[model samples]
Target chain A: MSRWKPDGRGRLEKAALELYNHKGFEATTVAEIAGRAGLTERTFYRHFADKRAVLFPSDNPLPAILADATASAPVPLPPLEVVTHALIEAAPVYEEREDLVRQRQAVIAANPELQERELAKLAALAATLTQALRERGLDTTTAALAAEIGIAAFKVAYERWINDPDEHTLAQHIRETLDTAKHLTTPAEHAAATDNVSFTGQQGTA
Target chain B: MSRWKPDGRGRLEKAALELYNHKGFEATTVAEIAGRAGLTERTFYRHFADKRAVLFPSDNPLPAILADATASAPVPLPPLEVVTHALIEAAPVYEEREDLVRQRQAVIAANPELQERELAKLAALAATLTQALRERGLDTTTAALAAEIGIAAFKVAYERWINDPDEHTLAQHIRETLDTAKHLTTPAEHAAATDNVSFTGQQGTA
Candidate 1:
């Protein structure tokens, strides 16, 4: 009943997710969501541009945080490291809204249009990471490969984290996944080449 | 014209791409594409299932080839190496159809629906690679990450190959790009510890 509640956005997101889950994203109206949150439609609009926006409210801040993390990361960090730093910085934001995240994923899974929008968002994120890597003086191929690999790692880690939340923190899981990926990708001879032999090959197309 | 020509599929693809470029994919009918190819609609159907199928002719063979390559690859090959070998197997197929490939890229670029389809295809390819890797006794995280990174490397190399044909062969370009991605992603200090010191970090949210 407090007029000046600090968690108004959180409350609205919680209500919107519940409504979206129970009645579906298409059937859930802003008025109903506002009512469920004990707020006005105007307040709901203030929090989210629209119902679809409610499912992806934090996306706005994602680019900026990623950019900042990439920029502040230690210079000469490997391409994945640069990307991993950014993911780590962004984890807390998603962690704070795990339920909403799950609901959003479910809604997206059910709707092709929403899935396309999500894909576009991911593509945009990759583009941003590529640009950031380029700014750090990585060549075009390296930048693109780094951005892509980074995104792939993020995706696998995220799916695992969501499915098995009790096992490890998202950051830990992602790190472990990256390590394993690196290990698996390294050639057996390279694994044995502890002293001096450098494994050499063409970069991307092979 | 010889009725038993080996380039029947190529001719059809060329004709279809030209028609698609001129009239747009949605507006270009199968009959028109067949006419341009100097073949009957029945002949076109023999080669392709539909108009949309022309855009993705390699859909059937790519996964199988990738699976075979992954399965038959030398045991304990590095993740990138395994992916590189699979891509190498695919190189000749892509190299032989460079013109059609560029045309396909243009057509997909013009249509959001086509782009989505392409994205879905790429995602499926990644999944196939992951599954193949998993069957090799790699853990889920390692398999997923290796597949994703390999695909990322392939994508980067393919783009470069399509953009500049003179730089290197698709297989060579892919190999170089994979190496570049791996090297760039490797931590600076532990560059020597190729196997022991695994690079760990979070993906950038940006």
Candidate 2:
């Protein structure tokens, strides 16, 4: 949780999120956010490119952190597991910032444009993670599938973690969500449960 | 495999995709698309809301067709299997539109703004499919997981199907991709291959 501080960027972000929620994103302007933060428009611009930038933060290091973690795995892991481990390792970075994270999610949810940007951001993260996995020497399709599964785990886990009343850590939620998804895909279960359904793989080759 | 009929909507879509791909999405306008299609600007607006709408048809029936297919399944099926079947039944609808589909993909890939709209559309499709699954008596988590996996399969399969020179059917690609994703999650394989890794469900669970 963030205690409102005198720090310029922190104050501006808190103010912008609050204002955006209260008055709606379109009606709220840069000057009002700056005024609420007890700062100037010049100071707000110094921290972010514009009103939208306050919430999105163009310089956010998440993609780089994720890619670095995936690239530096000391052991050879299944592509998805490698990305999963990388995600958990990077989880702590956001543990302390849940308040801001929640606020950002709410703001993005309320606005379609913001929601689009959020998805584009997630896509970019997945793209970088895919490249990192490829650099680890996995083939193109494998790298893509692994990165996508990892990103899907991250997205679903973050939603559950934020929503759960028990207040579990982000890493725990990620692990649990990843575990559930992995189980859904396992071969042993697939054989037992999928007998009623016929697969094209059973009939033809690509 | 489409014969490119002279229908109004078809002509408009062809003209719009060509203009968007040629001049870029932002640079092209509704009037240009109409002019190229031999229609009036009013006719263009009648077909689409604006330039962006031209790229993503607002009234695409795939969601309804998919939801209907899922709801019409005669027997109880696993949530993912229900979706896989729905996708296959829906495949025949697009089998003849490969050329337009490929053009649309190229146009969307070239524009970030168009890409954002595309993501929003997919999210909307997922939301509707989730609702459809929930209507079939699945819990929220099961519905969400099933819908997300269905969308992922659709995405990955479409990409591979389009890129493959042999032109395998979309339904075949979707089934194969689903199978591959399922295999990635098997416990038996996890036991043998992932000694360095730990999945929480590795111990137990469905």
Candidate 3:
């Protein structure tokens, strides 16, 4: 008990998943999670805030990572592609966790509070991406639209990736989804657009 | 007290807003809402399931209306224009309620639980639009993306409309937002889309 364990967090996550699967999320306790992980309740507290947090993935540094990736992308890539690269670069953390992710999603789906938290998290991600695009010199509304489109693509891709029995990367699904979205949203009213407001070629970033 | 009022829902909504503004949402109750509306609690129950329902705009028929508009639009129009037409057709209901809409939004913002409910409501609206697009012969991913993008444009446009004290109608705002979205999401990689899945030249309702 006095010895240090480097895999404290990972063990707790795994233990929590097993217990959650068998005993259900609301019925499970923090002490039981720590016990399943062969650790003390003090160690659980050191890692997670509560039993629920163990099942939920951490998105702390992701916004910064996504923003940096988007800013560094090639000057001419469209907004969606820039976001695709950013999300793809950040997809490794979600790799190899298919079983856990599906299970966690089921647990969340069964609970309305968890579902709201999930939506809030998704909204936050979209807002972060929107700000990142704005920093790249796009206008506010354009940045917001592009960020939302990117998120829509990511969501479809994530669900598709998990549903397929064959092993596939989240990044590939995102790339393909973006292509489909691009083709789908392609403008047919270019004439109307030109008549409406001529672009200055240098769009402002607010 | 026994007067027969044909506009019970409208009166209840008006009364609820007055009370909510005076005493905050958490402090307000259904009995009070019914009392202010000059109706019985039983009457209020017949109209709305709860007090929160009064704040949320009834969207029961909106999905069908939007979908029907999209399906009936002229062929060769872009996805954004199709959505614009769909929303513009649906905008009449919102045209006369600017004050109520603004107040409802304010009331919703002040409470976290209401905010979550608002997000959920938005998601449902998006889903309904997605289904509508699907009926227009769009593939699943394309349909979902277009609907989400359309909703984003509507959200931005609605906010801009409320903020500007100017008297631009919601339909005009929606039209302008769609044009803006078109310029923003114009695709860069055109080669991959060529022959990937050629449009039917005359796309139609399914």
Candidate 4:
């Protein structure tokens, strides 16, 4: 068989998901995944640390994008708005890879280990967002709270979007989820001032 | 050596945490943990499935307490208030076992597998709350959204209570966090109508 070309990572991930779905995560092996991808064991190792890692291929640039989006957000935006903007910016990345996203979700749903890694990654993401908010001068508690809310909204939206593929774009679903959450928290009479609070800190990182 | 007692689960957990801290989770064995707890392997097996299970001692009673609190909560209490009552019911359990709580947190923090179990437990708790809410006839999405918010509040309250031992009671911290999250969501202008909305649902399971 011809050796798998340089795009071996993508090939391996696709192959692994199929095998995992058919044979079960525990029964699948590295050798099988590599063979299916037409790549050698060395090529698989060069891309992922293990078979599980294939399910959650890391995106090294996501954090930088999220950080930059938060930093460049309009100065007077409220914390929720700041986070909303960052999420909106990040939605395209997920949207572009809908198939891979679905496969990853399925794999995680099947295996407890993969699900745990997914939660850890989300927790790490929240921590990263909290740090960014803190850098903008929010107090530790507020930063953590805001980051949690943002992550919650993102989660709600993502799940809904994934479940209903025909209804709306991920970005729109996220925006709607945020609006709904905000509405639930806001009484109809007070909706006017919801946008008035400034979430960003005036003092730059010293 | 005398035969181990059934009520020695606590002792085993304590011993396990101490050993984990000193020797790491991967290196610790059931025999070592049992020896440290003055128990035998047979007794240890009677309480827990294995070493990792010791890290996640069952807290089965928490769900029933939370469900009862939510079911009997005063009608028309704000959404946050309803959740606060549920969390208040869970406080004594955690407060009474603060040392174990801290040790459990440390053990989970130290090991990735345990961390995942912790997340799964939290997710299960959230799902339980959501189901209870659905039983009250709330729409699926609203139920989920409320449960997510409640879990977020619980997390904030938990960390604060554990980290700052002198602070208000866990119940008080939970109420305050819910209120804070509420206030952060709603500014002064919306206070009037926000209070008028009746949050009660008819007693009917979805």
Candidate 5:
């Protein structure tokens, strides 16, 4: 076998997920993942720290992409609007990885430990968004609240998108979920004007 | 040694927190906790499943109390209002254990494993609240969004209550935090009329 295989990381991830699905995450080993990928264990370590790391890569770019999007969003937008912009900006990152993301979510759903780590990852993303907003001059309370709401909307949208039969874009689901959240929170009398608040210019019915 | 110690569970919890704080949670052992509590190891096992259980008791009553309060809140209340009522109802549970709660927070703060468990606990509480709201006839999306928002407010209020030098009550913090969340999410054009929506009748300024 060749010492260097192109796209070694991709191969390892594909193999790891397949193995994890076929033979539980805990029972699978690094050696098996590498062997299945047609690579060596050394290549596996070069790509990921361990089996779990294959699912949750440390180089995940979603956090930085979101923080940058928040910072660059049009000024004077409410914090949630800023966060919504960030989600729309970051949605493209998930566009090409729907299958992988779905598989990872399935693996996480079956394991309690992975579920905790996934929650921590989402919480860390929210914290990053909060800090980014605070740096943009929002108060701590407002920043944190907006970040949490954004994550909640993202979660709802993700659930809907992953299970959606039509294969709609993640951005579309995000827009719909945010609308649902806004509608849920707004008192009934004020609900009539819900559409007037969309300043993102990218809004469309999901 | 007496086989029966009054308040043995409380003693075990107190001793476990002290030992965990001093020696770190990983380095601490069940026997040591039992010894520190002036109880036998059997008594320690009887009160808690393990050292970690001292912080996260299986019988934690907040979930049931919050769910009950959600179910019984005055009808026609919005989902968020119902959740807020549940939180207010559960606030009294923390009133008598201020010091223990604070200590537990510190211990959990010092340990990542414990922190994960703490996050799981909060997430589970959110799930419970969501189910309770769904049982109250709200749609799944609305119920989930309200529950997530309520938990976010609870987290903010909890951090403030634990760290506040003024010793403000958790109920007060919850009310204030909910107002802050409401204000943060409300559009700026409609911010002035926020107080008009308070139909809970239990509202108070923090």
Candidate 6:
């Protein structure tokens, strides 16, 4: 109830999420969120621009943190390695806040608008990773490819980390997901090209 | 001027793109598009749900076409190849309508809402491809990974096909982009792993 609480933003987020899940995102209001957190509406506004902003905060740190990590990777490493390495390096960002992240995912999953925002956020993260790779001297196409694949790997890893019952660390999940994704591209040694059955060659007359 | 025209939908689509590009998507209206197409507003309604729907038509054929292609592919191919082969098979959808697709991309790029719809469409396409791969007997994680990378490859190739002056077929571009994406994961023989300098190994203490 103190006005000068050190974790005002965190309190507001937790309260808003609780209200959103209890009723619905559309039904939740800023005043109710603030009241739940035992803070003034003014304090809520100071942390977030609006109710929806509580879910999709403007000042996300993941993009910048991953980008910085990617940029600082040692030279000559392949772009995928550099990007995944950055992801592994930043795993604690989510690992340390797993509960909040899990709740946010559930809330966002229930709302179509928030789902769109989630996709946009992921796209922006890919763009940031692309820029980071470009800074590492990769071509635009290669940078984009690596960044997109990196984001895909991260998504797979994060989903498993959240649902995993074995209590594996996010980094281990990431390493496993990265290997799974890589294995998807590499043809099995037993599956020879001669034995491969490709798609019907219905050539388009372009 | 003829309501009975066989290509009424195509004409309306073309008119909408022209107006959207000439002015803007927000500024353009169904009446204006119908007028530009020399068709009645009712005819426009029969084709598209709304002004925005002109850009993001509801009856998107690409997903179903690609899914069918993937499902029809010969068995035992790697998931990536199965997906990319489906893409190559479905390339004619874009190749036959390059001009309209290019103009549509330009219009969508200028509008945030349309961009979101485009992203959603691509995500849906990935989901369809993933399901197709799952039917092909791949695991959920592997199927999703291959589908995502396949879409990324499609995006890269589509951009090149739209902008390339040499008039290469979309299938060719897709093939090249797939190779590039696969090559990204493979380490160079000359660049020895022992000699390779990886990320600073700044592991996150999760």
**lDDT score for residue B76 of model 2:** 47
Please give the lDDT score at residue B41 for candidate 2: 82
lDDT of 5 by residue, B33-57 (tens): 9898888899998888877888989
DockQ of each: 0.28, 0.14, 0.21, 0.16, 0.29, 0.27
* Higher-DockQ candidate of 1 and 3: 1
What's model 3's lDDT at A50? Answer: 85
Each candidate's number of clashing pairs is: 25, 3, 0, 1, 0, 0
Off by over 4 Å in 5: A1-4, A187-206, B1-4, B186-206
If scored against the real structure, what TM-score would every candidate get? 0.78, 0.85, 0.80, 0.84, 0.89, 0.89
Error of 6 at B84 (Å): 0.8
- Answer with 1 or 2, whichever has the higher lDDT: 1
Clashing pairs in 2: A186-B185, A186-B186, A187-B186
For every candidate, how close is chain A to the native chain A in TM-score? 0.83, 0.86, 0.83, 0.86, 0.89, 0.88
Q: What tens-digit string does per-residue lDDT give for candidate 6 at A1-206?
A: 67558999999999998988889999998999999998999999989999988888888788878888998888867778888899998899889988888888888879877777787788888889988887766666677778888887787788778888777999998887776666565566313321342321111210
Q: Which stretches of candidate 4 lie over 4 Å from their true place?
A: A1-6, A186-206, B1-7, B186-206
TM-score of chain B only, all predictions? Answer: 0.82, 0.84, 0.83, 0.84, 0.89, 0.88
For model 4, residues A130-205, the per-residue Cα lDDT tens digits are 7886676555555567677788778778888888747578999888777766655533322232233232111121
What's the lDDT for all of these models?
0.76, 0.75, 0.72, 0.73, 0.80, 0.79
Interface RMSD of each: 10.4, 12.2, 16.0, 15.8, 8.5, 10.4
Between 2 and 4, whose lDDT is larger? Answer: 2
Over the stretch A170-195, how does candidate 2's per-residue lDDT look in tens digits? Answer: 99988876765654543355334334
DockQ for candidate 1: 0.28
> What is residue A64's positional error in candidate 1, in angstroms?
1.5
Q: How far does residue A45 in candidate 4 sit from its true spot (Å)?
A: 2.6
By TM-score, the better pick of 3 and 6 is 6
Evaluate model 5 with DockQ and give the value. Answer: 0.29
